[model samples]
Target chain A: MMRHWPIFFLTGLLSACGGGGGGGGGSSAPTQICTELNTPQSFTSVPLSAAPSSQPNSAPVTVEAYPTYGNGNFNIPYVTLQVCNGTHCVTVDHVIVDTGSYGLRVRADFPGISTLGLPSINNGSTAPIAECSQFLSGYAWGGVYSATVKIAGEATASPIPIQLTNDPNFPNPPASCTSSGSNIGGLNGLGGNGLLGIGVLIHDTGPYYACSTNGQNGPLNTPLNAILTNPIVSFASDNNGSILVMPSLANYPQGELTASGTLYFGINTQSNNTLNSTYSILPTPATGGNATFFSATLNGQAGPYPASFLDSGSNELFIPPLQPPGTYPLNSNGDYVPQSLQTVSGTATSLSVATDTAPLSFSLLDVTAGVNAGNTAFYDMGTTNSATAGSLDLGMPYFYGHSIVNGINGAQIQFNSTTYTGPFYAIH
Target chain B: MPYRYRWTVVLVGAIVTGTTHATLGGLERDVSHEGQPIAFAAATVHPLPAVPQGVHQQTILNLRSITLTEYSANGTVFAILWSGPTMPDYRSLLGTYFPSYQQVIQTQPLSPGHYRAPVAIHQPNLVLHASGHMGAYQGSMYDPSAVPTGLSITSLGIEP
Candidate 1:
């Protein structure tokens, strides 16, 4: 059956432009945490740990500021999630919460952290160890165990499914289960023990039977989406939602711009954060759909077709090269190619780039209201290339210097800045 | 005892059995375009039906119902076909590779907005192939006129 993949994009939509640059982040406000179901949890106020200090001289690295929901809920700013092993407990900041995927991953270096749970593998009567491959960055392989997560001040007992790496449980790890992108590093560097995929749905995909060349009649296994989970939806109140807000830019080549907003948890907390109107949504193709961006020529061969997507889980922009089909181990000189910007046409004389601190800007308008009013951002060049999707994935880099409001259920995006202020929701 | 055909018995037989009963020997079917065959595969009875003791020969039987099921190696059902005793054989309708495609009757170009397109019914042969191991099925569907067109689906049909 053809599943309705939501389509969101701007095509011959509107000509409205200009940004209402203004409000921003950074206040001495103490961190506050809340969930959809449970009461808010009050903790000793603490400033977020400073982002990693080191910078790659040639390569661009992007570090993003995301929130941890009360344990498993969506990103509610200043929420405390108690991540615990069997013995110890540590509260970590939850940011960049998402609903598009599943599984619970946490940074290994997070304070007050101790144990991890591993999944069980049933081989007839014997239960063996196992691991999972999360195609994006890396894999979260471990035995399953139960851990308690406290969000919005509510406590859930152990018997929770978790991933446990770096343990002596599995003596030999399969090369296929590990990541080929392990060596690559960035702002949201891959040092975390694992990521928490708190998506609404679980199981990577449905079950499948295996027919191997070895003549093994038994089933060849893959990770079922049912195993991994979103902690919030499973929490006492099931706060399974998120908001994403980015300011609009004043056209490309227009120099530095910025916008700020808040990502709230529930729909009722509409005052501060709200969604003005439905904006031009793009079709987020299902994973493995692998739709290639064919320089969809406008008139003649205008050259260079660049595509961008808003992904919160990713902290920085990633650009990959296109390739031909059927070749697994991509040859260095394969057809996969990446192009650079040359010009913005009619608007600018030419588009140029220096390896320094130049930034690109984008526009933001509700799909419903069209592009009337929005904010912009000053984006730092993070990477020159990637091994994944041949297109660029816009992450928190666009939200810097401004308050980003991700309207989960419409009027939930909130931002108050000096130059720009308004219920930016309901622009229509 | 070979009894001669009696007028009374012939009249009774004519009234009770109106439909012709033809024994289908070595049953086979095929799909074609215009009239050329594209691909062909054969199916056979499994385990062979039991032969009664002292039976001198195999009895010729007309195929009443054909239940065709295609599955993955692990027995995952991909397609199932039930011909209501008289339905056309999909194998003979869709050819080897389903070439008979549907074309778009109306063209409404989308401009970056949500749209719900009504489900277009392809020829029944393609539908049968789609119900079976869909892995081999191409996305281009055939319209009533057998013109090929793009199909982006959102949901399955609801039960009546």
Candidate 2:
């Protein structure tokens, strides 16, 4: 329905780009399309971990971080979650802690945990709903089911809606979601069993289906309480947002490896997650929504891409191509520069060649405050040539040296008294 | 059924000619112009509006979830850059190029990035590199011979 994607080659949006009102990520509101329920229900800090003795079961909720079995580019954080249906409790591991999206999506079966024989949430007429979580490279197709989900030692609410990728019964996906992308929610695609999207949006909306007679596409006119859900709102307290506290790696590993970190539940609920003032407050609002940028410049050219946000799920930081769409600009023949680095971590040295690109410089405001006051990380985004409709993506590589707080969608984040409804990421 | 509508070129009530990705590599630029005029539509894809690059005239077609760039110089299609939600339907998008594509794509080690799949194919007659994940995907294809003498792919915002 469109003719020449006309939003490229902009100098104006970049000129006015102030960046990171810290109002980013997650949906601004939970609507028929994207659901970010600003449920009046309050959430508190409840840490659930395999090593409960080692980590607290209270506020500043922390989950362990580990490396994936095959791929090592991503920091695969595992949260022990219990999916219950008043009948049985099923726990699983290798749930990626991704801040790029929202909602809880898992496989119906794990290595040790069997199928989550949960009940389905039909569209009143009894036709079940299927969700297609569309990724850039692919999509994850699954059926919508409800079960009491436990994350980090606490139960947000019983019977929260979730999409089950591993469910055998509803394995058949409607063709609408697959027409554009393929399903990668399985092991080969995500490199994990499932993803725990704690980003700003409540529901990961892509293509929804009313599963009855082989299924149909578009939005599934189901009620908010029944569709895919971000379990945070169901918590008794600390529902506003969560924090990812990944410690600096001693040395970035260049091969299949492992590391450790933590994922906390609320932003300001406890002393551990209290919004620190020194950090920059950048707002990453829901897709197609308006927000700010810290400030950006490319090739000494001011205002190329305005803002840059964080996504733990993404492995590398992708910057806009040096030259505009039709023009090629770089000293390198291709966009990638296969470079490796070995840094001294404490007394030891570590090497990592995760990104195969040259060095690049892009500026960004940090974990807390205003725009003019921010930091820039060195990266060689190496000429990424996609037409993504958002600011630059500061993936897992960007999260390495920093601790970020993803303020919940529609939650209020405050710098003293200057209160703002969130969808923001505070990085330190 | 988002993007299943196929409109074969009906020019002035007649079928005009164009090129597909496979055959376009060696064909004239106009063949491509005729082949893919508008991909999907979007707000980020650039409207060429007759913009000029090093030695080419370019317009970008954003297929909602994809971005296809058309470059022409010396009266022939020189190079094309495509980044889409999924691999462009290789069947039609690849056309004649599909035959030799698998040998290059499957044999090459999986390219790594934020997106798990990184396809780097460099056949004798064609060269293409594509990668994507989540909701953003990108790729570029070009015939080394079709490119202008002094021009490089990097000059066209393409990685080497």
Candidate 3:
């Protein structure tokens, strides 16, 4: 592992030098920075749908490997969203499809979205409600508003609560909210236009409490109905769950420039979204802090890791180390540097049934050269998670070549005549 | 008692002390000072079983039931752990270490891809690790030198 350190460090230096020359230029067409890097000749051959399905419940999912707007994004699934205020509507692209969170949060600064005149949600008093949704790396702060959300051919019958992040009206966020972490409420910070949280939970559950502009008052709980909510629950039909299907990139050592997939609404509701009998169903905790996570043991490392979960929002697989820190070469960015291609395995066990377990595995490769060469999608990319050893966050890389189903909490789905109460995950 | 009266006492205490809250590496008494201002419920203090003698834990439950626990021995706090629906105020929890933590976070590279990864800082004296998504978050921070002898920080079961 130590022998691999110099090569990784040198690669970082070269990439840094390559990107340094573009700083002083004026407005111009984005330069292709990675043209000089070594590009792979052979590529993986996997059959993939050229486009998203036209099914009423299906929506196109595009991977913008290298968007001109900001830095290169890998494995970040994006879908176009339409928000309406009565007959007036605005279509916003690059809205991230996040399975780790709940509800739709759009940037209030987006062109037509601000002019839609969506109604603001108030807290009984004259003050409008504001929210601060926290993530592992940062937090999103904004005002909660009601709007009609639509994706593909599915639209909400009535207006539902959504977050308008970076709202100019709510300029001053309380110290309590800002103190959570850095604010990733803008387009560049979010890596997309907005976030579409279609996780297991129906409602965004957290501290509903927020401090208002009126003054420094104690935290007040926003009414459940007024809080930012998952838009999938508001759809008239197919409201139970969703399935994310992506083509396999197992043979793509260098990753693809881009990939396309389909996000189908509702699980086991329509013929196109039915759950297969061969899939394993891992039930997750419906309430408490670990509500969205299940348990897993990775690389034969200890026993059960209670915080394991599948999250499309994360770009890579964050798993516990096969060995302790310092055993593997680590880059300045804290990513593990493998000397050669490596594959690790794990088992995800249902929280309820002891016998219900699913085999999980993925490959890991030193992504420095591939990323420098401008490739965006890599199936064999991951980092060791020393922060929380018990956590195994199988991110977007795990979604490829598989139909990962997320069953909403409290939603009933009929699968082969068997009624399965949701808040679960099934992978085929 | 009325909520207004409770807040008045908290405000007066802060004014007299000249400090808003306590943080990591502060005294055991500072734990209660930090918990009084924003805690949704009263702070709970209990002995940490199966650990070194004289070591105890203080648990504070905030508005969202976000639990922040401080482990202390010899009257000095050595470690702090938090887990719940949302992140706790690091400025209040990490105290003086907050600036260094922020610096590490801001400088950390996000190249190759923009992924929402966890924050892990491993300094010679300080080690902090936080991971989780929205609706659920957990992490632990400790000072290696401050930790009591005969106790390993990893064995504390700090994270959920």
lDDT of each: 0.25, 0.47, 0.67
Per-residue alpha-carbon lDDT of candidate 2 for residues B18-67, written as tens digits (9 for 90 to 100): 22222344333333332234443443322223324445443333223344
Ranking by DockQ: 3, 2, 1
Tell me the lDDT of model 3 at A118.
89
lDDT (0-100) at residue A103 of candidate 2? 73
Residues A1-428, candidate 2: write the lDDT tens digits. Answer: 11221222111111111111111111232211221111111122233211112223232222222322233223345566767777678776667777766678886556533454677766546556656565543556666777787767567655788777744544344332432234565664565667877775555443444544333222223355555556776665567777776655423233123345667776666666676666556554343212212223345333344334456766555554433422433333234333333111111000111111122232221111110122111222233433222235556655655677777657675654566556566667
- Please, what is the TM-score per model? 0.38, 0.59, 0.82
Which is the winner by DockQ between candidate 2 and candidate 3?
Answer: 3
Considering only chain B, report the TM-score of each candidate against the true chain B.
Answer: 0.17, 0.61, 0.72
Candidate 1 lDDT, tens digit per residue, A1-428?
22221121111111111111111111232321100000011112111111221211111112222221111111111223566755666665532243223445454334434344423433222333233322232233333335666554334434354444332343222222221112111113222234444321222221111111222213122223224444543444223233333443334322222234433333223232233333211112121111111111111223132323333443333323322222111234221112222211111010111111112342221111111122122233222222211234334444443333221111112222211111111110
Q: Which stretches of candidate 3 lie over 4 Å from their true place?
A: A1-55, A69-72, A206-219, A324-329, B1-22, B30-49, B109-115, B158-160
> CA lDDT of A348 in candidate 3?
90
lDDT of 1 at B104: 18
Report the lDDT of model 1 for residue A217. Answer: 19
lDDT of 1 at A58: 13
Error of 2 at A335 (Å): 10
lDDT by residue for model 1 (B23-89), tens: 1111111000111111111221111222222211111101211222211111111222221111112
The numbered model that scores best in DockQ is 3
Interface quality of candidate 1 as DockQ: 0.02
Sorting all predicted structures by TM-score, with the top scorer first, yields 3, 2, 1
Of the candidates numbered 1 and 3, which has the greater DockQ value? 3
